[model samples]
Structure formats: C-alpha cells, structure tokens
Target chain A: MTREEVAARVVGVTAQQFAMKTSDIKESDQFTVDLGADSLKSIELVAAYEEAFGLSVKEEEALKVQDVGGAIDFFFRLLQ
Target chain B: MKPYELQDVPTPNLLEDTFPYSLPPLIKFEGKIKETIDGKEVEFDPNEVRTRDIHITDTTFRDGQQARPPYKREHMVTLFEMMSRLGGPKGVIRQSEFFLYTKNDRDTIDACRALNLKYPEITGWIRANKGDFRLVKEMGLKETGMLTSSSDYHIFHKQKQTRKEAMQQYIEVVEAAFEAGVRPRCHLEDITRADLPGFVFPFVQKLERLSEQVPQHMKVKIRLCDTMGFGLSYPNAAEPRSIPKMIWRLRNECGVSADRLEWHGHNDFHKVHINGASSWIYGLNALNGTLFGFGERTGNPPLEGAVIEYVALKGGLNGVNLPVITEMAEYYERVIGTTLASNYPFVGKDFNTTRAGIHAGGLRKFEQIYNIFDTTALLNRPPRVAITDKSGTDGVALWVNDFLGLQGEERLTVMKVARIQRWVMDQYEKEGRMSSITDQEMEEQVKTCLPEYYQAHRKN
Candidate 1:
C-alpha cells in the first residue's frame, strides 16, 4: 500500500479504537498524550491495525510507534 | 574508593556463566572459608566440593516418622523405590535410615530390599544399647546409626547418666556393632549444644580410636546431629554452635575423615537446609535430611533441596533424575495424603507460578526472566500465571498461550486476551470478587473470547 493509503487506514483505526471521528485525528497527535490511548488501548490499536492490514507487527516495535504518522510510516515500511 | 564506569555495550549481557538456565545456578566459591577454632585460624578449601564425594543421606523413615504417624509398609516400599530413582545410580542419596524395632519395619525393609535397587542402602537406627545390636545383625544391614547424645542436656537430663557412664555405654554399643559386623554411625545428638572441647572432642577421639581397630569399610561414622537446631554456619561464631569449627575439630583435631562425617540438622531456627549444605563445604561428605524437611520438632534438612544444591555445587546432574522430585511430591500428596505448601520451592504447586502482571509479561517474552531456572525441563513444571485483579492483559495472554500450548508466531498477544482480562478485572472491580481466576475460568474465557484459536489448538 502507498503511504497515503497507510495513513488513511491508520487514522481510521485510531478513530475507531478511541471512538473519535477520522477528521479529529491528527498525524502529530501522540497516542498517549493527545489521544486517550492507555496501555491497553495502545495495544488494542495495534491489534486492530494488525487485523485491518492482515499483518503481525512485532510487539516491541509496534508499541514504540508514538504518533499517527509513526504508525502509518511503520505499517507502510512493513508492507514494502 | 576505587573508580568504576559503565561499560555500555550494544548487546545485553545475561551472565550465562552462573545462570545457565539448563540447570540450577552454579554456586561458585572464591577463596578459603576461615574459622577461628580454639584460638587458632583454620582455613577450609571450599573448592573441594567440586570433586568431593558429597551426597545426601535420608532419615525420612526414622526422624521423618518421628514427626508424624508411621507410614505403612507399602508406603515405605514405594517411597524407597521412588527415592532410588530420584537419586539415580550414582547414589547421590547414599543411605536412608529406617527403624528396625517393629515387625512392620522389618517387613517394609524386606519389601524395599525386594526392589533390589542399588542406591539408598537401607540402614537401621537404634538406641545406644547393646541389646539393639540384635536387630542390626538380624536385618544384616551394613550400617546403623546409634544414638550417642553429646550434650549435657541429653547425657545428664535425658539419659540420666554422668559423662563417664554415657561415654562407656556408647562405647559398649559401638563394640557390639563391631562384633555384629554392622558399621556404627554415632548419632552425636545435640553436638551443637555440647561442650566440644570438654566432651564432644573427647568422645569423637575415643570413636576414632575404636574406628582404628576395625576395617576401613566397617569404620565408625560420626553423624553431627544438631538435634536442637543450635548449629550456626556464621563465620567467627563460637564453638559447639559453629558448624565450621565443629567439623574442623572433628576432622583435624580428633582425626575423623570427611567421608565418615555427616551433618544432620533440625529446623527449629529455619537454618536446616543451609546448615546441611554448609557441612558439605566444611568437609563432611553426607548431609542427613528427610524428604520435605519432615522430622522431629521443626524438621531435618529437606532431601529435595539438598538434591538441587548437589547439582548447583557439582555443576551437573551426575545421573540424578530431577523430575522424580516432582513425582515424589505428587506421591506424597496423592498416595500419602499430605499437602506441600503451594509456594514451597522446587515441588510446590505455585513455585513457578507468577501473580504479578510485570512478571507475566516477562514470562510471556522470555520465561527465564521470571523463572529461577528451567523448572519446566528439570521439574516438569512450566512457568505459569495466576490471574487475579493484579494480572493485567499480559498475564491473560500468557495464561491463554500456555494453555493452548502455543509457541513462536502462534502465541497470542495481550490484545487477543484483553477481553478476558477485562472480565477478570471486572470480577474484582465491579463484583468485589476476592479470589484468583481459576484455570477453568481462564479456559472458559479462551473458549468464549478466542474461540478460533481454541478450536484450532486446544481441541486436540
């Protein structure tokens, strides 16, 4: 998938996980700070992304993705 | 102060030298262990344990029976057979003493002899009386432990004999054992509370002289019994109580060989197991212990703990079947109708089970992080997580993955078990549940939440 497609999917998953609108999510918004993703929520987001993309991200590396842009970039690189 | 700096490296150093994960962590010794005995400095070579013929001797039937009701003949036979396998062919558990007083005891000894195992040579225990020599002769045993109480507390109070009378009585029994061709292991009861210079040393010297008259195989053995659990392994400790000094005086001062010396201790002060192991380091060969530390008053050193310690000191199993310890524990519970504490080391039900979420997380990532050693491979007990309010999603994930026997890529992540964790949390948070989530509850949650994996993996 392209970076734009990855970004769109990442935003969509984050919105669904936190029960927010897609327009309200931002690339600079931190998963824990700006968005209300607790430890379990962050894990849930990763699981949701894994399900949505049909890919298993390494737990340590996936948990390191801090923001929406970082998640998109991580999945995009994994996809390539 | 010497300067120190952090030598940061790219990779983590797990220090596999000691924590090899395949066995118990190796117990390495640095220089000589020193003890001040009789106003003189004495040094004992701790490294000798690596090559020494150090081993465990059992008193389960003798002292172990003293704490509880007697085990049936069949129970004794079965335990004896299991002990043979547990100690293996090399006889790490060299001898097990039994009571030869009753018809039941003789019958059990015969039944155990019927198994025809080589290790754990059955010996008899009797009072320091010439009449009891008949039982040893009748049983045709090679060795017997005869009580020769060393302390004034025992000699004066218990035996109602002066020091001279007690020594003469003990010597007569030893002579009788020699006449009967049975090796006498003098049970120096309360040696740790005795006058080492005044009585214990003199008695041991007399035993040494008696041993000189006999053949090497039939020589007198001295069991330094800490009957009151007053023995101390601490450095610079005083005589009688100091295990190091007592062994030193017996070995160096009175001329007793390491092989002929044994350390038997009680757990009145919770120093039972370490004191037994310390005896090995202090130059004794046999550590007298009962299974699960079951003995008089508090208990003797645990035979199973000594087995693990043997591996640690020797740095190898040396044919000892470690898993039989688990089997023995199961036998003690199932057949013997006894229960071991869940948190008891090595054989407990929850010895390797984790209750903390952080520990479960580490266990999920790498079991060696939370586990003491490879208990799963060694003791047939894998690291486990007991889910409660404290066990977060990580614990649920570990429990689920371990239950399904999933490994590598198939192991479930915390996200997959989040719902179960949520329900577990709600049990306490919402419903004020105060107990741990049982394995059955976790299995049901797996079936309900992660039914696909359960179907694919657990159905078998």
Candidate 2:
C-alpha cells in the first residue's frame, strides 16, 4: 500500500483500537501521544502488521519502524 | 526456537513446586485474561457489589448488526438458547431479551411469544413510536421496551422532533403500551448523547413524575445508548471512566434502579466490553449485548463473551456448557456468510488460539494453568482452545503432536498431510499477501519442518 494509505490505515486501526479520534493521529504524533498505545500494544501492533500483511518482521528491526510511513516502507522493501 | 526446548521440556510446576498439571478436561474457559502471551499484567476495576435481581436485555440485533456478519433468525434462537443455558431456565426467559416493535417485526415477537407461551416472558425491544407499541400489543409481548429519541442527533436530525416532543411522544407511546396489556419499559435512547443539562435531565425529571403517576409495576428503563458506540464512558464524554462510573452515578444520583436501568453500548470503540462488564459490576443489573458481538460497524460486546465471563469466570461455574460456543459461532458465521474476525473476543475463531512465539511458548507453560479455572474457588472450566495460528514447521508440528498426543513415528507425514501454515503466515506478514502460495508450498513447509525422526506418541 502507498505511504498515505498506510498512514490512513494506521490511523484507522489505532483509532478503533484505542478509542481515540482518528483526526488526532498525525504523521509526527508518537503512538503514546495521540493513540495511548501501551508497551504491550506496541508489540501487538507489530504482530498485527505481520498478521495483516503476512510477513516476518524481525523483532530487532521491528522496533526501528515507527510511523505508518516507516511501516509501509518496511513492508514494501520486504515485499520487493 | 521455543522458550524451552521441546524435548526434555520442563513440565510447568503448576500446583506445587514438584507437581505438573495438565489442562483440565471438564471445564471450558470463558473469561478475558488480563495477561498477554508473555504474561504482562492488565488491570481491571470491579465495581461496587449489588444484588443482581434484574436481567439485561441486549440489542445486538439492532445496534450490533452494523459492523458484523449478518445475524439471521436461527442465530437469534441460538443466542437465546445460550443466554438461557448460561443463567438457568429462569435465565432463559429473563435473558432472552430483544424486542420487535413494528408490525413488520411481529414475526420475531410472535416467535418469542410462542416461546413464552411455553416458557412465559421473552423480552422485546421497541422504538419510541406509537405504532411500535401497536405491534407489541398485537404480538402479546408482555415484557416490552418502548424507546424514544432523547439525543439532539436522534431527535433533531434523525427523528426530526423537538426534545419536548420526544418526551411527550415517550409518554404517549409508553402509556399506550401499558394500556394494551404490555409491560412497559421505556428506553430513553441517547440519554448520554443527548444535550443532558438542557434536554436529558429535564426530560428524565418529568419521566420520573410520569412514572410515579403509573403503577410501580409499570417499569421505565432509561437506556444509556451509545448509538455511535461513543457513549458517556468515552474519553470525550462528560466523563472518562467508561460506563462503570456512569452506570453507578445513573443509579445512585439519577435515582434509577438496578431493574429500571439498562446499559447499551456499541463497539465503535473497543470499550464496550469493559463498559458492559463495568456496568454490571457498578450497579446496572441489565446489560445489553449482541450475538457473536456482531453489529453495526465495530459490533456490540459479544453477549456470549459477557455471559461467559459473568457465569464462567467471575461468578465461577464449573460446568456452564461453553464448549459448544465455538461450534455455535461456526454455524452463525456460515449462515451470515462472513468469517468471524479471528480476533473477535471470546467465541471468535481465534480468540483462544495462539500464534506469536512468546504466546505459543506460554501456552506450552500455562495451558495447564487454565485448568485452575476448573479447580479454583472463583472460576472453573477447561481452557477452550484450538490453535490454527503458528509459525515454523517445528512449532506447528509440536502443537499438532500436542493436540494428537503424537510421539515416536507412525505419525502422518506433515508434508503429505496437507500444507504449511507457518510459512504462509510469515509470507502473509512480509508481503501483506502471497496469494500465489500453492498447496505445494504448504506441503514443502510441512515436509521440511517434520522429518522421519518425529514420532506421535498417542496410540489409537
């Protein structure tokens, strides 16, 4: 998916998951800031990304991926 | 690699330092675990204790349909059966609480009345319209709820009526239902979302007066409907405590009762599960739910889940017959033609299933700890689990052998048995999809992971 699409998806997923307003999610907005994502949830999100997209994200490399764009880029690179 | 080696695996010290425990076979688990796979703790707040004399009537039928797969009539019957079976025979009538208020909906009400003729009392849901009351009358649905719009959105925008008009309308329709031999339970819809200071409280004040004028048996249920799933317990709501504190305040401050107060939540946000749970713990005896948690948009709290938790987990029933919930869900999903979100709470296809490495490892640890539910003082049930998620052929084979109790050879070849789920799951993660993975791809995963050295020990 495109980066913007990924961001939208992130916002959509986090909004529903966290009960936060979707508009509150911004590109620079840290997960802890806008979405109230806990440590467990952060890991769960990575698992979700893996499960949703069907790819392996090394637990080591997974931490470096931050924003929705980063996740999208990581996904595309792995895909290619 | 597993957290521990599969061979020479250290059996978990469950009861004492020396004893090893396996999962109990008699109990089927039905509660939310505060811990994640690796066993991080989650917090839960138990509300003030109150006598649970009132029964909750769930409307997943109306509110829960938006987000989920379709719920047909038979699905409704199955839910009724489950609700009854959860609480008891009396629980059946007290809990089989959904409504049909329109002539078009009479068939379902008639169906309920038919059920009631044999059993007496299947609760019904109703709109706040006068015409809706007529249908309740025709169906002879004695225990009926008549709902009227109280929120600005519903009154001004959807129903196009003024607050005063909605109140008057509520009075007119509820009175009509009472006159027609129906037990009147008025649902003040959108009470939370309503312009409360200006509209809701004043209307409620007058409703209390109207209620006093009627007989005490003429019940009025002020339904706190989070129509968009964003209710008073929401972060943006006038409060932040989800629905627990709200229900408590509504009961204590608003002068509503355990019997007359009903809480309805939507899952647009994920709080409905906690909200519904807290409402009961707080004070409201009647909590609403949908089957399979299916409903509009995100869906309602899975009624099966809430029932499971209430009876099987919190209240602790040793034999509540929850083993069939998954099977029932399978039947409903088929009729609805939508796969249950594997992650959907409780009865969802994968709720109890595990996949993550830590989770799988932990399952290998406490799969027996769940046996505690069956033996514990509070809860008792065998943990219900059937894993369809995992990674690596070894992991898959281990779980399969665990399921089949296979050991030592004579085990069916994984490669020849079917396909590779772990590799496919990994591929799915990496690429978002690998639709091209053929049956052969799965075969390779099984073959490479499982070799001739693997032996299933369970003897036929």
Candidate 3:
C-alpha cells in the first residue's frame, strides 16, 4: 500500500471507530483530543486498523500513533 | 538534617537482600532490640529467629472450634491430614491441639492418627481438672494444653476463684499430667489482661520450678495466651499488654526457655498475627494459631499467615508446602462448606485479581510490578484480572491470553481483545450492569469476538 492508500484506510477506520465522516477526519487530528476517543476508543481504533489493513501491527507502536498522520505513516511503513 | 546525595546507578536497585521474590520477603535485623522493663533495659537479639527452631502449633480444633460450629469427624480428619502436608516433614506446624470432651472429637483424633502422617503430632485441650488427664492418656498423646486462667477477669469473675485457689487447681492438673506421662502445656489464658508481675510471673516461675523435677519430655510448656487480643508488640509498651516485655520477663526473669514458651493470640484488636510473630522475635519458639485465623470470638493468629511469616523470618520455606494452603482453602469450601473472605491474603478468590485499568496494564507489561510475588509458582494462583468497566483493554487482553493458556509473544495483544473490552464496557455503560463480568460471560465474549482463536485454543 502507498502513503495515500494507507492514509485513506487509516482515515476510514478512524471515522468508523469514532462515528465521524472520513471528510471530517484530517492528518493533523489527534485521536483523543480532536476525535474524542477515550483509552478504550483509541484501542478500538487500533483494532479496527488491524482488521481493515489485514496486518498485525505492533500493539505498543500502533497505540503510540497519536494523530491521523502518525497512524498513516505507521501502517505505511508496516505495509512496505 | 544529615548530609545527603543521590547515588544514581544505571540499573534499578531492586533490593534483593530483603525482597527476594522467590521467597516471602525476609525479615532481617541489624542489631539487638532493647526494651525497658522495671527500670531496666533488656536487649533481645531479633536475629536469633534466623537460627532458632521457631515453629507454629495449631489450635484449629480447640480455639478454632470455639468460634464456629463443630467440624464433622471427616472434616477434622481431612484438615488434620492437610495440616501435616502444609507443615511438611520438618514439622514447622509441630502440634495441633484437639478437644477431648465429645466422642466425635475422639473418633476424629483416632481417624487422623490412623492416617499417621508425622508432624502436627496430636494433642488435647481441656479444663484445669485432673479428670481430663484420662482423655490425654487414653489418646496416647504426649502433650496436652490445660487451661490455667491467669487474668483476674478469668479468676475472680469467670472461674469464681481467688488467685491462690485458681493457681492450686491449675497446678494439680499439671501434676496429674506428669503422673500420666502427658506433657502439660499450660494455656495461660488472658495473660495480657492479667497482673503480669503479681500473678503471671509468679505462676510461670512456679511452673518452671515444677518442670525442673520432670524429665525433658515432660517439662511444662508455657503458652502465653493473649486471650482478649490485648498484647502489644511495640517497644516499651507497658506490661500485661506489651508482648516484648511479657516475653522478656518469661525468658529472663521467670526462666522459661524459648523452646518451652509459646505465644497464643486472639484477633480482637487485629494485632493477632503480628503479636504472635513478635513473640517469636522476642524469644519464644512456638506460635499457637488456627487455620485462616478462625478461633474464639474474633480469631487466632492465622496459622497460614504464621506459616508465611515463618518463611519470611527463616528466609526459606524449609520443608513447608505452601501450595497446600490453597488446597486447604479449597477443601474448606468444597467439603467443609466454608468460604474465606474474598479479599483475604494468599488464599482468597480475589487476592491476586486486579480490577483497575492501570494495574492491569502494569501486570500485562511486567507481572512483578503489580503482584506481591510469584503467586503462580508459590501458591498455584496466577495473578489475574477481573473484567469490569475499570478494567481496560489491557485487562481484557490479559484475561483472554490466560484463558487460552497463551504465553510470551504468542499472547494476544490489547488490540486483539479490544472488541471484548467494548462489550465489557457496554455491560456497565449501555446496560447499566452493577456487577463484574463473570468468567462464563467473558468466555462467551471470547467465543463471539475471537472465534478462530477460541476454536483453535479452547475447543477441547
């Protein structure tokens, strides 16, 4: 998957997890602060990303992806 | 203030000197502990416990029975057999005193003796009456504890006898025990509430003098019974209540050797276990206790607690079988129909179960961070997470991995169990559930969420 593809998937997963629109989700939007995801919601987003991408990302590293841009970069590196 | 500077190091100083995780944390003493008694400073070497033959004697059938309904004959026999294993070959739990009044008690003693596992040698408890000597002699028990009430509260109020009359009656029973070749352990009932200098010291001195005439095996053992839980372990805490001073006086002033002196305590003040342990440090060899602290009124010092303290003080298990404590708890629940308090240490249902999110996270990262010791290795109980709203995804992940018997990197991550954690939250949030998610419910959630893993791992 390329950067745009990873970004689009990460955005879609984040939107689905937080009940928001993919258009409303942005690269700079923080999972907790901007998207109103609590600890459990953050974990659920990581789980959603794992399911959507069909890859088992490192839990600690994936959970550390604070913003939408970070999640996109994280999954892109894993896909590469 | 003393001059101080940070001695920073590259690695953490985990202080293995005291907190060696394989064993109960060791009780190390640097120097002698001093106690002021009768305007004199008495020094007791606390380190003596490391080498001393300090041990536990049980009163489960005696004082323990006083608190609750009488255990069935088989229940007593099973508990007695389990106690022998719990103590092991070295006899850390050296003796168990039994009631001699009923035929059922006698049959239970016979049944226990029939199993014939050594250590926790059977003994009898009876009033200070010579007639009870027949029971001790008939049972062929080498030792028996005879009540020799010490406090004026017991003598004047309860027994309706003056101090001299009570002392005479107690002495006659000791004499009868000697004649019958049964070693008399004088249970100095309510010694903590007695006039120690006036009555207790004099009584113990006389008993010691009497012990001089008998053979080594027949010497009178003094059990300093803290009957109402008034004994204090603090330094310079006044007499009649101060455990240290009472023990010091018993060993030094009254001339009772450490081996012949036992500390029996009650939990009326929640100081039972400590007071019993402090007696060992203050120079007594035997701590008289009951299983799980079940005894008269409040309770006795928990024999299991004392067993843990014994390992801590000795810095090893010696011959003690610690996991049998778990077995004994199970036997009590399954057979004897008793359940220990859920929060009770070492042997409770929730003793090692963490419910908090942050604690579960710590447990997931490193078990030692939240667990007291290796409970799985020591007590046959792994540290566990009880799923609740407070138990986050970390808790869910831990519970799932443990249920699947997964280990190391094979264990599923928090992300894998996040769906189950959401269901757990929905119980409290959406459904307004007030109780924790039971293991059965969690298993169903596991089956529903991670069907493949559940099928692969738990299908059997």
Candidate 4:
C-alpha cells in the first residue's frame, strides 16, 4: 500500500479506536497529543498498526517514532 | 512517578460530599411475559412513554467494542441473543462499536441488513458526517446514533471547530444518514459541561427545529453524556451529585417526548449509574449501558448496576440475572486481557464479602435488608471477605470444622490468603496504572483477590 493508504488505515483504525474523528489525527499527531493518550494507548495503537499492516516495528526503531508520519514511514519502509 | 497510582489522580471538582451514599442497588428484571402457550419471550412494550424508562436500548456492540478488540458482527448477534435472553423493555441492536472502523464492520452491517433483523432498532454510533453515515449502509445498518462534539473542550481542542460549524456539519451529516435509509440517534457529548445558554441552546434549537421538520421516526433521539465523569457540579465531595444536574434540568424543561431523552456517563469516581438512574427518575425514556461497564477511560456506569438498581430499588423491570453477570464480566476480562478490582462492589469477589469482623458483623444483614448499619462502609470500602486461619490457632486439634465457619479461616496449607492478596497487590502496584481505571483491569483485580476464598474453602 502507498504511504497514504497505509497511514489512512492506521489513522482510520486509531481514530475509531480512540473514538475521535480522522481529522483529529494529523501526520504530526503525537500519541500524547491533546488526545491525552498515555503510554498504554500508544503501545496498543502501535501494536494494532503493526498487525493491521502485517509488519514489525522493532524495539529500537520504536524509539524513533515521534508522530503518525514517522510511524507510517517506519512501517512502509519495512514493507519496502 | 509510578504508573498505577498515576491513573488514580484525583478528579478536578472532587466536590465535597452531598447525597445519601452507597453503591446503587441491583435491578431485577421480569422481561416482557407472553400469553403464548410456551410463553415465548417478546420485545414489544405496549406501554406508553411513561415510567422510569420507556426505552430498552443496548449500546454493547456499539460501546462494548470500545473495551478493546471490537467484536465480529457474528459475535454481536450472539451477544444480542444473550442480552435478549437477559431481558429488556427495549430490544438489543447495538451496531458495531467502531461506527466506521473496518471492512469487517461493513460486512457485519451488511449481514444484519440481509437478515432483516428487527427488535433492537439497529443504531450505529457516528460522528456528524456524510462518509461516516455512508458506512452504515455498507453494513446494512438502517439506524445510527449521530454524535457531534458539543462541549467546548471537544469542539475547540478535539474537533477544532466552532460550535456553529459543528452544528451545520451535524445537520448535513444527519441528512446524509437519513437519505441512505438509516434511523438517526443523536448524541451531544460533554453536554454536562457545554454552555447551556451560549453553546447548547442555539445548537439544540436547530435540532428541535429539525425534529419538528422531519417525519416522526426520522426524528433523532438525543443522549446527554457526562463524558469526563465530572460528576454533577461537585464529584469528589462526600455527597456527590452526578455530572451536570443542570443537563437533566434542561432535558426535562425542554418539552420533548420521553423518547428524546437518554443519559450516558463515565466513572472517574463512580457516579455514572447514579446519574443514569436519576435521568430515568426524571422521565428520560432510554438508558444506555455496556454489559460490564467496559469502555474508554473509567468507562460508563456498569449497566449491570443500573439494571440491578432498577429492580432492587425502584421495583421496576430490567430483564437481567444479576448473578450471571459476573461470568459475563470474566469473558470481557479474558478478551480484553485485564482484570476487575476486588473492591468493585457488585461482581468483585470482595464486593459482597466482609473481612473485618466488625464489618462482617454489620454486613450479614445486607442480603435481607439491603442496608448495612453504616452505609458509608459499603461506599468507602467495598465489602471485603476476611479469611482467618483458626485451624492451628483455635486448637480444635483439627477434625476439619464445618469448612464453612471456622473462625473465618481463610488460609491454605502453605500460606495465608491475606498474604497472597498482598502479594498480588504488590505486583499490581509495581505494574503502575495511572490516568483512569479501565473495567477490564478492575475485573482482573477481583480475580486476583478471589484466591483467598478458594484457599479458605479447601475441601477436607
């Protein structure tokens, strides 16, 4: 899937998961952004994103995820 | 800072005490009885929109999915069947939890449409939008609860919209749902905090205008939610009112059919059910619930408690077997991978049991009278079961006493149950859970607390 498609799925799923609008999630959306998502929520979303796209975000790579775009890029690059 | 204790952060208003306090009573429901030869169960409530709640509604598939891994459509059907078995004045039709989450959600909606399921009007949750409502049709869902942010917090911080735009968007989105042949249920979030005069009044005036403009079933059923669990004006106080009694006042004063009013709540400090129960008393037609109060944050009032309160306190009907609900809770825990707290009151292992000799002595009469000598005991501290190991201390030379009442002996051959409880708690404390408590973990805590009872009752 293209970056947008992958991001769309992840954002769509995460938005629904947190009961928010997709517009609520920006490419720069931080897990702890105004949504007040804590670490547990962040981890849950990451795992779901991994599962939804069928890829792994290694622990070390996880430290580099700063926003939704970064997370999506990490997954997309892994796919490549 | 530790994580678990972090979730326990005190609420904002944490208002001083106010009302007669105790966990609300359990409800007993004798659902719609039939004159048919076999007495088959039925859903139609012939009564007019009067009484505690005229509407029987289920938000499980819609709300329960928020618990964790939302269910498959097939799973929803089975859950509905079970809820139907439990009984309700309103039949069960909670569209999937995520209003528009997945292809599977769409598939489930389509399956419901193909089956032509009727009973609990198939209402799905949605934001005010054309696409969001459009997905309902893909799932074959004909009814939907269209929610738009009403609270300033949601509009500005969450949705980044002015109240005016959200209202306009609401009308547009709702119209779309209608064009696609879906029933629209309207939910106004943070209604408890939204400015009644400035924000809410004008917005609702438009909806009122819409209700009058639309065909009857085409009209929306509005639900008021205490989203953040900011109970009434003051939640932290000893006698706390539920979130925004002012909302209830507005709901009542605004001339509308009881069908139009519904109440939803979360439990930051445990008053959502009381708020819901109060709404029922005030003539709101429909009340919402999750099977075991599983949802985001502190979660909504345990519908189990609401149903119990109706039957046990108000002499009304709910159509649920309160005893069996614990097992249903267990299922929720396993699926969500969490637990319940020992002190959760209704389903917890310690909710009905007593640990302190003085406390147990007072609680022994509760099953009969429904009142402990001091009601505060039940509130501040959940009924705890104390296990005293008298096997070695009582010095009966141990022929194995009644196994039922041996100085409340609650220890096992190797260790005391109290010690085990402490051990489990130590583990939980180390795990760290801040923000707000979720229902799944609360259930897990109860399971962890039960070992003492099991160990205490070891067979001879």
lDDT of 4 by residue, B324-416 (tens): 455455655565445777666566545654434344333432322323312334323233333332111111111112132333332121111
Q: Interface RMSD for candidate number 3?
A: 0.6
Global Cα lDDT for candidate 3 = 0.91
iRMSD values, candidates in order: 1.6, 11.5, 0.6, 16.4
- Candidate 2: C-alpha RMSD after superposition: 18.3
Clashing pairs in 1: none
Model 3 pairs in collision: none
Q: Give one digit per residue, the lDDT tens place, for model 4 in A1-80.
A: 79878788878877876899998888877767755665435555665676687765553466457677887787777777
Local distance difference test, each candidate: 0.91, 0.55, 0.91, 0.55
DockQ of 2: 0.02
By summed lDDT, the worst window of 10 consecutive residues in model 1 chain A runs over: A36-45
Best by TM-score: 3
| All candidates in order of lDDT, best leading | 1, 3, 2, 4
**Candidate 4 Cα errors over 4 Å, as ranges:** A1-80, B1-56, B67-78, B88-98, B108-120, B231-253, B316-318, B333-337, B357-386, B389-460
Q: What is the TM-score of each candidate against the true structure?
A: 0.95, 0.61, 0.98, 0.56
Question: Which residue runs of candidate 3 sit more than 4 Å off their true CA positions?
Answer: none
Docking verdict class for candidate 4: incorrect
At residue B99, what lDDT does model 4 achieve?
Answer: 54
